[model samples]
Target: MKKTMLIIVLSVFALGCKPKQTVANTKLDNKTERLMKGDWLVSSVKYVGSDVFKVTSFNIADAKCFEESMWTLVSNNNTGEVVLNKANCATFESKITWYVNKDGNFVMKFLSEGIKAKHTTSGYVLKVANQTETSFQLIDKAAVGSNTAEIVFQFDKIGN
Candidate 1:
């Protein structure tokens, strides 16, 4: 009877201590990442709501400056760069690390000069929409008064 109780207790403990199963990256995430690997240009920036609310994209500049910006997405290392080269806007380049999570959200962290991506604790999460071989959109939702509006960044593949 003692041996039987010991075995039962051990089994209960072992079962209680079982490791949690982590969610692995899905095939759709991999496919989306693959499709995002290329040179892209922000063809346009569309605001879907009231003009009174000014939205700053990526917390860096106004949404208008992002139009015509150049971006490079390297899938292998999940690292890329963005160049804000629109006329009358500040021309600068920023390194970014990005990946599509299991939930299909686009997670991106900007790395400043001399700063490593892993050390940065803050980043941006945006919903990816209208993805295609040659085009895609990054949708950022902002609260306008009591309504939620979307700032869409339309990207078009620049070159092969």
Candidate 2:
């Protein structure tokens, strides 16, 4: 009888001590790291909504300045940087921090004024519509002045 009671207690203790699932187990933390750790080219940029309309499809070839521009993402520390070579538009580069939040949304944090004086502030959360090793799509719906705009950024792998 004593041996049977001891076995029962041991089983209960073992069940209570089971390991919990970590952020790594969710797969996003690891996947985000794997997919973003490289240099990407801005393949396409699109905007729509009250603030902006769907203009003609544009790519690096259409914009000469943009051709030299590149986006580098370092997933190990959730940091990123963008080099804006559009001198005709602006002459600025930006350092950014990024992460996948609890809600599974991608968040960007700017340490300074950033690439665009009007566009670069904290709390820009982008949704990952689609992603793969060769390509990635991020959508950001944000308020610009009194109007709202939906911006889509499509990137293609260029190098590591």
Clashes within 3 Å, all models in order: 0, 0
Which pairs of residues clash in candidate 2, taking residues 3 or more apart in a chain or in different chains? none
lDDT, residue 31, model 2: 72
Return the TM-score for each candidate structure.
0.79, 0.59
Model 2, span 1-160: residue lDDT tens: 9999999999999999999865521224557656878898877666654323432212212233344467788888777887766556554466777776545567766556425433644446677767889888777664566876667778789954
Q: Candidate 1, which segments miss by more than 4 Å at Cα?
A: 1-28, 50-52
lDDT of 1 by residue, 1-160 (tens): 9999999999999999999999644334878889999999999998875555677787888888999999999988899999998998878799999998767778889898898997998988888899999999998888777988999899999878
lDDT of each: 0.88, 0.64
Q: In model 2, which runs have C-alpha deviations exceeding 4 angstroms? A: 1-28, 48-68, 113-121, 143-149
Clashes of 1: 0
How many steric clashes does model 2 contain? 0
